[model samples]
Target: MPRYLISFEKGAMDHIPEEDFPEVGKTSHAVIQEAKDAGVFLFGGGLRYDDGDVEHAVVGTDGVVTDGPYPESKELIGGVMIVDVPTREAALEWAAKIAVACRCAQDIRKFMYDPDLIE
Candidate 1:
């Protein structure tokens, strides 16, 4: 099975939350259960909506500490799910379900398994 990451895109909440965000709590649990039954879900979670406040960058060596998201981007990671599926199609199906459930656009990406190259 291949691992895929499903992330919610930024600023998509407006469209889905106009009425209400039914995707939280109760509905999320149902989705988790469904994934579990299908044997593809490893773990999934939501991220707290926070501004870049309380964020800092530090360089460390030899057990020194660092505090930051490393190479920063305009958008931070919002939420994620780790899914193990037999194919990209299966992962996309799961990501679609998560998108509807989370009421946000989901970015589906596969984890690289090859060890020969470095990013």
Candidate 2:
């Protein structure tokens, strides 16, 4: 089985007004429920939807802690869903559902496995 990560940016929905967030939330949650019912849902969660340090933690290799969101992008990670499926096509299908529900672009990435961890 292959695990896929489906993630989106927070500001990607800036075109959508804040008033419509509830509806978007409902739609996305529905997709998560569907994934759960299909037994492919591993884990999923939404970011704090803020640009503050409270929502994100950055730890350096030296164990130094930085307070703030990721500096690489102005937009933060809105949400992420992880699924384990049989093929890339299945993962893409799920990504499409999420993209439509969130009304935002989604990045679907394959997860590399640790051979030693596989029993």
Q: What lDDT does model 2 reach?
A: 0.87
lDDT (10s digit) by residue, model 1, range 1-119: 67889887545565665456654656767877999999888888876656755454556677765666556545666678888888999999888887777777788889998656422
Cα lDDT, all candidates: 0.74, 0.87
Clashes of each: 0, 0
**Clash-forming residue pairs, model 2:** none
lDDT computed for candidate 1 = 0.74
RMSD of each: 4.9, 2.4
Candidate 2 Cα errors over 4 Å, as ranges: 51-53, 69-75, 116-119
